[model samples]
Target: MLQSLSIRDIVLIEALDLDFGAGLSVLTGETGAGKSILLDSMGLALGNRADSGLVRQGMEKAQVTATFDAPDPASKLAVYLADNDIEIEPGEPLIIKRSVKADGGSRAFINDQPCSAALLREAGNRLIEIHGQHDDRGLINPRGHRALLDTYAGSDPAKVRQAFEGWQSAKVALEQAIADQEAAEQDREFLEHSVAELSKFAPQPGEEQELALERATMMKGEKLTGDLEAIRAAFDGSNGGLASLRAAARRLDRIGEDHPLLAEALGALDRAVIEAGEAEELLNKAADALMFDPQRLDDMETRLFELRALARKHRVEPETLAKLLTDMETRLAAISDGGRSLKTLEAGLAEAKSSYIAAAEMLRLKRQKAAKALDKAVAGELKPLKLDAARFETLIEPLDELRWGGNGMDRIEFLISTNPGAPLAPLGKIASGGELSRFILALKVALAEEGGAGTIIFDEVDRGVGGAVAAAIGERLAKLSKAAQLLVVTHSPQVASKGDAHFLINKSIAGTVSRTDVAALDGEGRRQEIARMLSGADVTDEARAQADRLLEGV
Candidate 1:
């Protein structure tokens, strides 16, 4: 609900403040009493187009601020605010403000955060609705018709959506699988030959490096083996220097036992014998380790060449041949087992399709039932609003295949025939303004509990209506206010009499400047205003008595 509005230097409103309340608040005034000024100021805050003309003649800028009561924790407006990351303190009012400069530029803000007019407009849409003779811009957008119908029918649309998405996913999966199977079948012969070739070779990971190392060692060993043998012979052969040294050491060991100098010579001979023994062992090991074969070298080199060639043919490193083998085998297996896998996918898709069809059919049936009830309810409101000749229908025609959607295969549109034998067409195409307002009224009454903005404003729902018809409009407005605040600008005293709060808009001149001010009427003031409305520029005693009678009934 809009709690307050402040306007500064806007057109004829120099500075003004107004407070609103829940329920039906009526603004009544003589013609051209700055009623349009009030609407314009509110439009600024609601993100309507702004220009230099909107600023007062002597002022540089015009500003308007509107404050709204915080939305319920679970309301759509609250959800919208949260989703947009709009900062709001705990229990803070939702404040929207707009400023227009003489230069024809404007700025908008929400909760004091600088924002764009589009965002402001969206937020305003969630909080308020302004309807007039030429406007049914709130509940009649046609997009909300289906959702409102579902709400009226009390059906679970979410479940239907889930079923639809499940079927769609299954369908996509089936198509992808069929495509893959076709591709694999096209390459079946190639896959078979590749798998066979790789199987025969059975190349192992890291084998290329192992084979190359062996090849290098064998090739090098053949060139170095002779040199290694000469070293071994020098240490252990009988005609080598080691043999002469050993003979001299043995002779010294036998005769040097009696003297310290001879003891030292014996120890030195022992050390030399030990050193030679160690060298002989190492030399034997080295000579044996050089066992080489040119044939083995050729075999290893040839095998390595084959691995490298295969790797290049497959566009992979030699180390990855093992992985390629596994993948090719899997592809072959899939090709062999394609029919069974495709059958499984098709079966799943069929089950999902069946579930979706069932849900959509149920929704269709329920909507049909709901549509009939809505038509009857709206028809009942017709005669009182002087629309007895109009006929309302909910058109639920099947959509074409290309237009099918998750909501169902039905295109729901509200159609009206304003005269007997006239073809039914979309409401916007067939109904007059008064007829539309009545139709909208009946819809609001039917969907009063379905939920909408916390406030709804009507420029003149009673247009072209009078007497009991006008009273009925007032009654419905009051009834709607139970769910949300309602403000009406009306000329019917009967309608004005129904207001929970009444305001009178009047204009006056201060020197050469024109100014407009809205006055909240009390009991006496309301009586005088209603009397003035009942009469013409005069509050006759009879009009006052009639006004009292009207207020008393309310």
Candidate 2:
């Protein structure tokens, strides 16, 4: 419920602060008393559009703030505030403020944190709904009619919505699978041919690298083999260099003991001869190990080239050919099994769609039942509001095809015929402004609890009606207040008298500035105000007595 509203420099409102209470509160005054200005200031605080003209003549800017007291802090609006990074002060009212500058710049804030006007509007929508005489006619909108029906039904339409979403997902998957299978079927023969060719090739992992390494080894040693053979022949020949070195070493060792100095020289020569013999033997073994057949090298090179050419033809790296082979094999397997999978998916999709249809049908039936009850309830309200002969009906038209996530394929609208024997039409098309206002009030009274908590502001909904009809409207507004806060701006004394709290909006001039002043009235003050409404700028004793009676009844 709206707790308070503060306005500064907004048009005729120079500086004003008004506190609101729960239950029905009505604002009343004569024409040109700034009633509209008060409403506009409230609208601005509720995130309505702003204009530079709204600023007072001497002021640089205009600001309006609205505060609400939520019964539950975890309400939808509270959650939205948290999601938008707005601070939530503990035990404090939810404050929304809007400011417009003389230069046309505008800013909005939620809990003192700056926010976009769009965000403020969204938040305000959750907190309050202001319906004027012209605005209350929206109850006839087809889009809103279905929602009212569902709310009346008290069923979770979310179940049907979820089923629809699941059905859509299944359909999309089935379609994609069918498309893939069809494309695969078109290339069935080509896929078969490729599978057969690649199977014969049988590309092995790391085979290319192994073949290249073998070819390299064989090619590098092929010419070296002849030179190694020549070296081996020289070392193994009888009386070759090794044999001569051995004989020289023996001769040197035998004479070494004859003389001390000469012995040292002979020892060193024998060591050198022995080392030369060992070198020759090592060279002979190395040469034998290096030998390879030229034909083997040519064969290895041919096999490596074959692998490289296959890699190029397949448009893959030599190493990646193996993975390509595996992928092709998997594709072939899928092609072989695709027909069976397609059948399974088709059956699953059919089952999901069937479930959705069943749920939707059930929901549609429930909505139909709910619609009848709502029509009867609203019709009962019309008589007291002076539409005793009018007929209200709920028209439920089921669409030909089911729309996923919609309200169960039913396009529900409220239809009304204002006079007896009149042709029924869409409520908005048939009902006059006054009739629409009453209709909306009837619906609001019918669905009072289901619409959630918020301050409901009825802006002159009693327009074009008077006497008992206006009194009935006031009664219903008072009844609505039991569930949520109710605020009415009205010219009717009947409605004004029913208010738990009364405010008078009047224009005043102070120091060459025109300002709108709102004052909460009590006792005699409220009686005088109601009497003024009853007598139009004059308060008579009879009107005051009538106001007192109305207040007592309320």
Candidate 3:
């Protein structure tokens, strides 16, 4: 609830501070007493449009501040503040301030932290609702009717929202699957051809490197074959080293043991002959090993070149060709079975849509039931407000499938007929300004504790009515105060007597200056104010007695 309001340099109000309490508080005064100025100052604090003319004549700027008790921690307003990174402490007050310059520029703040006027407006909306003859926001707007109806019905929208989201998700998945299948069909021939080519090549890991090395070794061995043959001839002919060594050794053996020197020489010649023969045999074996058919070299070159060509075609090194083949084969398999998967996805989407429809239907039923009850309740209030012939209706219209939303498939609006035998039309189209205010009040009274702002202010809600009608309005306002704080601006003495607190707005003029002041009324002061309201400028004893009776009646 609003705790206090302060104003400075705003039109006729030049520096005023007023504290508010819970329940119904009444503000009363004669015409031109600055009661409208007080409400304008509040509108400024609540982020209403700023005008340079609202500033006092001699002041450069006008400012207003409103303080409210902290709302529930789990409330939407609290969550919105947290989302915007505005931190508020527990049990601390929520202070909103606005300043408008003479140039029509304005600045806004919440809890002393600068914020945009839009943010201030959003926060203010959750804290208080101002209802007047010309007001078009809140309950009067058709866009908000469904939420209000849902609140009154105590219907939770979470199930419908969840089902709707699931349906959307399923639809998206099915669409993506269809697109993928179409694309795969276009690439089917290419995938099949590539897979077959890779399968036939049968490329092996490291095959290219191994073939290159073997070819090189064979070429080097071919170059060394001539040298190996020449070495073999030196050891093989009759006059070669091996033959000469063998002949010398035989002569030495014939004169064996004649002298120690001859014996040593013969032994060395025989070893030389044996070693030369062994060397010739090893040389022949290496020459034979180096021999290779020319066609074998051609085959190796052909294989290596083919492998390189395939690697370049696929934009991969030869070693990775094997893995690429496996991937392409898997894609081919998916393409072959795409029809089955697409059918599965379609079925899932159908199931999700069915679930959403069921949930929406249940929600619509709940709203319809609540609407009937609401109409009856509002009907009960109409007669007391002097609109007995008027009829209230909750119109529930179904939306097209293309326009369906998370809130459900229905559009709800409040309709009314102010005269008997007249067709029902929208509330705004059918009701006069005074009638509209009373209709809104009746609707509000019917709504009761279901939904509303933390504080509700009605500007002259008792306008154009008197006697029992005025008393009936007061009775309902008092009843509303039990659930939320209420402030009424009225001239009705009965309404004034119903307030938990009373404030008197008065205008004073001194020389060239005129100022407005607000004073809280006590026991005698309240009685005097009520008597003044009853008897105009002059307060009569009879009016005082009536005021006494009115006060006692409460």
lDDT of each: 0.85, 0.81, 0.90
**TM-score, predicted candidate 1 vs. hidden true structure:** 0.93
Model 3 lDDT vs. the true structure?
Answer: 0.90
Query: Tens digits of per-residue lDDT for model 2 on 323-414?
Result: 88788777778778898888988898899889888998899889889888888888889899998989988898877773446457777888
Q: Which ten residues in a row have the lowest lDDT in candidate 3?
A: 284-293
Best by TM-score: 1
Residue-by-residue lDDT tens digits, candidate 3, 1-554: 99999999999888899999999999999989998999888888887888888999989999999999987888899999989878888789999999999987999988999988888888888999998888889888898899999999999989999999999999999999889888988989998999999899888878889889888877877788788778877888789878888888888999978999999998888788888878888887777667665888889889889889989998999888888889889878888899899889999999999999999999999999999999999999999999999999999999999977788999999999999999999888899887998999898988877967989999998889899999999999999898889989998999999999999999999998999999999999999999999998889999999999999988
Write the candidate numbers in order of decreasing TM-score: 1, 2, 3
How would you encode candidate 1's per-residue C-alpha lDDT over 1-554 as one tens digit per residue?
Answer: 89999999988988898999888899999999988888878878998888779999978899999999876767777777777877777687989989999988999888889888888888888888887667746656677678778888888778778998999999999999999999999989998998999999999989999998878777777888988877776775677867878888888878887788998988887888788888888777766665688787778888999999999999999999999999999999999899999999999999998998888888999999999998888788777777788888888888885675789878888888889889998777667777777777767776778777778878777878888998888887777789888888888888899999999999998798788999899999999999998997977999999999989978
Q: Which of candidates 1 and 2 is the stronger one according to lDDT?
A: 1
**Cα error, candidate 3, residue 74 (Å):** 1.4
Q: What C-alpha lDDT, on a 0 to 100 scale, does residue 37 get in candidate 3? A: 93
Off by more than 4 A, model 3: 202-323
lDDT ranking from best to worst?
Answer: 3, 1, 2
By TM-score, the better pick of 1 and 2 is 1
For candidate 2, the 10 contiguous residues with the lowest summed lDDT are 132-141
